[model samples]
Target: MPAQADPEPVTLLLVLEDTETLSSLSDIGEQEGLRVLHAESAQDALAILELEPVDMVLCDALTPGLDGHEVLELIQERWPDCIRLLMTDVSSGLEEALRAIDEGHVYGFIPKPWHEERLRLLLRRSREHLGTQREWMQREMALLEQNQDLIALNAALEQRIEATQQELKQTAEMLDKTYDELLHMHVTTARVIGDLLHHRLPRHLQTNEQVYALVTAFCETHALDHTLQQDLQLAAALYNIGKLTWDDHLLATPSEQLSANERTAYQHYPVSGENHLMAMPQLKRAAKFVRHHRERWNGNGFPDRLEGSDIPYGSRLLGLAVDFIELQRGMVLPREVPRPQALALLRKFAGRIYDPELCHDFVKLCVEKAPDLQTSGKAVISLETSQVKPGMILAQDIYSASGMLLLHEGKRLDQHLMDKLKNFEEIEGRNYTVLVYRP
Candidate 1:
């Protein structure tokens, strides 16, 4: 292997008007491992400094064209980091050296007849100082690069976080829309099944309408959720759906007069209704309502026998409505009971068979709010299909010309329902005379 050559020594610029002094200092500098560049005048020294890199500059105070102070000052201004020293002879007294030091133009002074050892020591110290400054510059550059990298990383991380938040927001919106569409589909399916059942069993259909009316009033008084109210409505319309599987004798017998086998069979209807509704995920909440509607308040009812608050809120409300409707229809007792008698019976069984607070609220709604719902005092007007509008309530059942029931009485109309009626009329060519409460 070839040996690596030794690195070049630190270079020093010597500016002097005396040739003898320059020759003497050059010999000492080379022995001290320094490269000496000779400049006979201050102008020559400045020119050399401009053209090359020099570690230090040693200049005579009385140099022609520029004194030591002038040359040092120029070096400090243009190359501030370069070390400067003044060499003073007897002619250039201590006063010039003091002025150079005071003005911050020179690092230190070297007297004439300068010792070779002292000159060598000063040159070695200057080289060490230059080495320290170079090390500091390298460290500072590394720190700057690290700071820039950190800034770029933070910017990229922020962009990723913003993108993730936007994706989450869009996903939430999509889920809400999908839920609403699914809910609408379940409501439509339940209504269609209810209509079919009502067509097969007209008497039960009438009972469902009355029960649904009571449930609506009860829910409105308690400030319940509108979605929950719709669920209760669907459950009530299909309450007796399980009776479809029963024989004529079991179906004919009044619920209060059923034998042990018939009553046991009747008790299973709620479970049967739950099974029918459980297949639909959107109606799962309604299925739970149906399953527990028959439960009594004191835990003595049927099926789950859930007591008090353990029963679903919708089921509690349904229990009250079903009994009240059954009472009025004479299905509970042998003779048809009057509304006042039914209210009294409900008050009698409040804590036993129904939630007491709900039963009390139900009685008030019936006596006070029920009359307001009736078409007797409301503005009931008959309108042709062309005159129908939204926000109106149907005062009487809307039937097709063929006597098929289109919409039930006391049902509120909206844009969708109004459009449905109009569409049916236009398509079927059967005109409808609908009696609606004036909005």
Candidate 2:
């Protein structure tokens, strides 16, 4: 490596009135590797301090215009980091030197005529103090930069976290809306299947209405959840969907009068109905309700043979509703049983074929609530396809000109169903006369 260059000398500023004293001090400072700058007055010295990089300042005690003490005080105010020293002769008052030191304007005073060895020693010590202060300032600047970088990074991280939270909220809302649409589609499909069955087997229209009404009343009385109540209502409307696969004679025959093979086949309708509903993922819960609707409280019913309490509550409610409707329709006996006789028969089977509590509630609902639902003298009006609207309950079954049942009495129309009826009429080259409840 090349020989190392000598370090740059520290700059010192000297303010003095006497040219001889300034020259002598400049010679001493230069020998000790100090670069000396001379100012004849305090004003000149202050001007030098503003324009130059200075490491140390020395002032003669008797400088003209401004005293050495006043010059040091000005340097302390304008350049607090610059090290200061005072030069005093034997005639200079000891009180002035003491005041300069006490007021912190000077580090210490040097006596004149100055000794060469002592002057050299003082200059070396002052340069070392200046080096230490510069190093400290450098370290402080570095720490400030690091703190600013950390603050910026923390703000960026907070912004990213807020953005992620907003995205999650939007995703949750979209999922909720998608779920609602899927539920609406599933319900519309079930109603279409129920309408097809009602057209083929006209009696089911009345039975579906009675069972749904009874189930609704029973669930309300028991304070069941709205989700379960809605499931049971859908299951009741679509209960006999499996009968579509049955032979016409088997469907027409009363349950008590069926042959052993016919009864066994009839029992499989619940399973078939569950299979049909399971095709739609959104209807899985209602499918489960339909699958166990025939299960007995004593576990003697077909398919799963699930016992009391083990049977789903919605299924138990459905069992009571279906049996009660079947009895009133005379599907369980040769002649149509009166509503009072149907209630008695349902009570007789409670705890064995039905949940005793639900059976009791069903009886109360039928006796107290059934009368209000009867449309004995209610006005029924016919409407062309263009005149019909959603939310209107059907007052009579709508059939095609060829006697094909298009919709059932008590089935509430919606936009989708109304569209289907219009499409069917257009396809068959006939206009349908839709009957709706007046109120």
Candidate 3:
């Protein structure tokens, strides 16, 4: 048979006066995996206790010098962590037994002339107590490791949160600088367009206040923030700035038959806006947005051909507003479709010409706030020789008698027309609609 695993050993201190009893107990202890240190008297056991560490101390209550109670008291003081047990043959010493239990901190009592099974039982209980002590030590070590890990994890999380907060602060500053640049570029564009309008008109011309009013209404209706609303108004006010660099013939030319040069000149507005804005880094982001406003959402429109969501959000909003204001001024072909019809047409081209979401918001805003379209305020339109005081509409299209158009429409005018009026001058048999203005 395979050698049985050695039973767990226990250190025991035995105090006895008789040699026979010590020899008998030693044999039984060896069989049960107990390591015994024998003493002839209680005094000897106390000396042993001072010299070595023991798990349990087994002693007699009535030893000659320094009884079991005396020896236990010394053991309790020196090795307080050790378990103590008292053993005696005299029944008369039972009273002292109670005293040993109370004052000596003894763990148990064993009668003399000890039975083999009884000694085995006592040792087994002591072994179990030692096992419990070891298990407790293991648990304490595991808990200490877990606490250290938790502290490290908490420290790492705090560092990440601090870094994220710092990054957000920088991003906010960058966005602010970009907004200021957009406004400056827009003002420059307006001045150039205003000068051109004055040069072309017979009397005077100016951008309409109705444009600003409509843009403000659009922003409010769509719940756009203040900065975004201002950007939209500025963009619409300056969209036709490149027209100033073109010849008077083209500005007044009908849209249906534009010369090749006229078409090319008209297409340069976005570039003009970009060139003026890119001098400042803060303005560069806005320049990009402005340059791409004419691009189609379906990869088919001018300059950049940016498609769908690829176009900057700022440019998309501006494009929708500019188209609306131009249509109201009768600048576009077909005598500028009515507001309802214009919105309907824009909706059809959403996701192809303008951002689909912005288009939807623009249409909803116009229908809900239709009255803001009425024109107000006066802006000076300066020409080469003289500056117009305030009340002339440039590019007004008058019709011939034969259903042929005779004039063009401007993007903005000082006076707002209540509606388009029909004209029948110079052409035979047919009539056309005229873009009329009141001085």
Candidate 4:
């Protein structure tokens, strides 16, 4: 409980002016568990005080060369924390003795011939008082030490919180970077599937590139959110993936020219495409768009005839993009239609075949943005695979003989790309036209 106050022991100094008396009193103090020291004169007592600390003092009224009261009063001035007592005989004036108690601040007076019982009782009481003081001081010291420990803990806790905040910030940045990389990888994978379909149908026509282009343009001009943009673009590219599993005869035939058996197998391609995309976790959103892309505005469509608002909004957009391109490619009718006529067919069946409000927006987008539906506005020169060169820009989309856009319009050819074109024609065992801007 208390230490900045020096922990002096419970000790008593008896200044008797007689050696025999000092010896007897010292024994009594010892019995009371006190550390006792005795001196025969004021000089000896004052000297002991200089050498060591004392808690209680008992002195004779007639001290050698000095009054006991004077010595005790000196102790008061020098060490106020010490307790002072005086002893005297009948010859010493009682009035003087009582006055000493008041003037010197003495504890009590003792008779000239002290009683053992009285001395013992005083020593025991002094010992109890010292013990109580020690307990109180110890308690005060313990509280101070606990306060110091709290200060240290508070400092450590603040440091830990700061470090934790930094760690959380780093983790968030890492997650954002990872999400961007995964998005790039997903888009690239969808493009590869479109290339695969190109190879599978060696001589057949396809609208994969035109659908990809129109859908991407629409999303940008319309400012669709990122999730919707990604989903519709991937669906546009991969909606015909199910046709890969079909026989060449079925795939080459137009929709209106297919037999009843072929038509039944063809109608199920949309679901087959959905199943293929569901295996990839990143394409889960796109898979939903692919499955319902054929749903009609009324109640009659293929795969799942979800009508009205039951069809997801992104699926509706995918449908519009696919039909716009495929109609021109002659995949929807027995004969291919021009871009204007294809647009007319979409408008003619708008409320019954597509979401009318979204169709209105889409039809307008195609007319405004698709200025080169057949590459009309560009001066062109055609080259054989061997004549192509690096740095020449493609005036039109470069397609495989089977109608896969190997490179898009406006791409500047490089040696690596030229090598790729030659290598592809080499594998296919046929040559195709490469149209480029006249340089």
Candidate 5:
């Protein structure tokens, strides 16, 4: 094994006018194992800064050209990374020194004829702070590099998945660690696309989250594979992304309102969303589910008309979720119905339009989780956004000014979700009547 090398010493610059203080600082630097350089004036300090990399700068408050605060402020503008300490006469320039601390120009003020103990402590802390700053910068650079690699990985995901299942699992794990950073950049891309859908389709706000909630609940209740569960959740967010290609007229019209040609165009969205997502390998399973979400149980569904158990299990669960939410949105029908009615409408279509057993299991999951859906008579209260608390079950969906559903009925509130609602209120300037079933 090779011997390790020594760490580079800390470099410091002194622009002190007091000869006694300058000599004391140099002795302390040597004890601290620092590479110390002294400057006669502020101008000399600036010149040295231009030539050499410095970790910390100590400037005299009463220097010949610029006072200590003024010198540190100048250092801040040119080389803001260095830790700065100022020396000042406590009585004469106290206000100027205080203002420099407030404005963040000077890191700290050292009174003239400083105590050795205090000076040593400040220097030790400054070294620690510099180390932390450098560490954070390294992390930021690494994250940027990871983001570029992630983008490339997302681009070639299809080819990579075909190579080996072990490699596929490894890629999935990386995507998990930086899940928020995977593709579409910065945050989850599906969420970004979901927001886009919220803008283009108001019904999306009303139904998308409900779809996700239903799909996830069903997946969990059935104890589905963790990876497949993640794929279904992503699919639930994006099943209707193909609707982006539709014209405003087609997008705005209800299914019952659409003409034959428009209906045909509407049925194409599931396939369209799948095609858009197919190039990325990680999302292939999700895309497959999105592609077949419109398929029916008895071969009446569109695109390929996959019937009964022939459809992928995730797609089957996803389709049931989509219909259950959309049925209540009045998206597939003329008039909007309440939650209990929506469940009934979903049940009515089970055998012919949906997988019967899955439909039955979904209704049971809904009734058990959403107390307000039951006829067991739970008291419901309507509260303002600020009044709602965590653990309370939402009795009704909260909608945006644009009629996009912000939070779905039966969703539980946590501090994070409360913060989201507060931010939304601040940004959108809207108030909502939040209904919660009493615990």
Candidate 6:
């Protein structure tokens, strides 16, 4: 015989006045893996709630004395986390439902003749939410343990207690472990957000050789250090992280098209994006770029008013690149502008809108690199070994025209070996492919 699997615990409280309603709800609740507690009145419901941990509350609006609205209000006061659902029999009782929604803290309301599927959906979502809450609670409990350890350490030190050093060491170790766990969590979250943005953005970006060429030449021309170059790439890719907090509707609309409230909501993206990156100390420097990415060279930008040299160099580089991309893609509004026109516009606003020196270097790079920046308009199959030079990063997977994986990054193929690899038939047809930064 196989070992038995433990049953999932069900934790839901049902407060219904009508006997038939209770019977129907009970059957559905049990089938859906919930342990249902039944209550005929508000007082009984309150007692059961105090005795058992409940994840959700379902009340009947038509109940006599201490109606669903009043019961929901009381539950809101005591158990604010519980998902509240009220079943209404009469259409006129919508006011109570509104009150429950506005003040009584109801998550949702269902009609009296409720569909079983909708209830099941609500319960499933409620359970998932409860699980996330439980995870947070576990973290809080760990914090409490650390606090107790600190208290013990303090008491031992002040009272000249024995084993004070041992207590201090143990407390230090626990704190270190806690910090490591939190740090890992922060990194994992940032990576997830990064992956989401990469997947959702336009694919044409991969083929735009001008973008990469201009950026690289600009870095070289300005004599920018390697770290600043890396910062530029990271900031370019993540310039819009703040947009994640924004509603899809608002993000899709032009800034001028947004309503007053939507505009206010839109301003939060930069701060939210910064906070998201700042959580991991490893990426703290990267977070600073996101915060200052929008500042103009002049003293007129959002969130902060830092002008010219006061704005970070990394942020200034990203701001220029992102502005170019937005203009090229016509993200501004009305219509997308041509590359020459956009460049001309950038020139027009150089000193006031962008750092004059940086803008000049950027434009010069684009002009000088026009030949190398030209693409053959054919899909790049695999990167030639000759083109696999040092200091260049792989933008995407290297694949043959037949879709075979070639060389992965962090794998060195210095000039001579690259020459032989380039001679292969699969690699012969493709020109030097675009090199993209991975990290």
Instruction: Supply candidate 6's per-residue lDDT for 384.
Output: 40
lDDT ranking, best first: 4, 5, 2, 1, 6, 3
lDDT of candidate 5 at residue 71, scale 0 to 100: 85
**C-alpha-based local distance difference test score of model 3:** 0.64
What lDDT does each candidate get? 0.79, 0.79, 0.64, 0.80, 0.80, 0.68
* lDDT (tens digit, per residue) of candidate 5 on 328-357: 777878777666566777799888888899
Name the best candidate (by TM-score): 1
User: Which segments of model 6 are wrong by more than 4 Å?
Assistant: 1-195, 198-217, 370-439
Q: Candidate 6 overall Cα lDDT vs. reference?
A: 0.68
Best by lDDT: 4
Candidate 3 residues 1-439, lDDT tens each? 8999664567887787878877887787777777988989876777777787777777777766988777788888888868887776646666777777776577767776567788778877866877686567668778877887888887888888888877887887777777566656565565454445556743312333444566667777668876666555555555555465667666655444576877777778788877865775644665666687778888886687778888777777767766665564455553655544566678998977888887888776665444333335332222211222234553233433333443445534332221222212222433332222334
Candidate 5, 194: how far from true, in Å? 1.9
Mark the 10 consecutive residues where model 1 has the least summed lDDT. 368-377
Tell me the lDDT of candidate 4: 0.80
Order candidates by TM-score, high to low.
Answer: 1, 2, 4, 5, 3, 6
Worst ten-residue run, lDDT, model 2? 366-375
Regions of candidate 4 where Cα sits further than 4 Å from its true position: 1-166, 202-204, 371-439
Q: Candidate 4 residues 1-439, lDDT tens each?
A: 6759655568899898678888888888888777889888999999999999998998888899788878988999998778887888846556777887677567677776778888777777766776776677788789888888888888888888888888988998988788867776777789788778878664437677777777887898899998788888788778889888898788777788999999899888988998999999888888889889989999699877789999999888889988887786778788876555677789998999999999999987765455224344444566786898889987656566555668877899999998898888898897756667767
Per-prediction TM-score: 0.58, 0.57, 0.42, 0.51, 0.46, 0.40
- Residue pairs clashing in model 2 are none
Candidate 3 vs candidate 6, TM-score winner: 3
Model 5 scores worst on lDDT over the 10 consecutive residues at 179-188
Candidate 2 vs 5: which has more TM-score: 2
Candidate 2 lDDT by residue in tens digits, 1-439: 9999675568999898789888998999888788999999888888898898888988888878888888888879888999998888846656778887898888867888878788778888888878788778878988889888889988998899989888988998998787666656666666677777666665543466667667767778778886776677778778878778886777667889998989899899999999988887667788889999999999998789999999998888888888877886778887766545667789998889988987887776665455224566565555677998889998656666555667877999999999999899789987766667777
Question: For residue 295, what is the lDDT in candidate 2?
Answer: 93
Give per-residue lDDT, candidate 1, residue 307. Answer: 95
lDDT of 4 at 55: 87
Q: How does model 1 score by TM-score?
A: 0.58
Taking every candidate in turn, the Cα RMSD to the unseen true structure, in Å, is 10.9, 12.1, 13.9, 13.1, 27.2, 35.6
TM-score of 2: 0.57
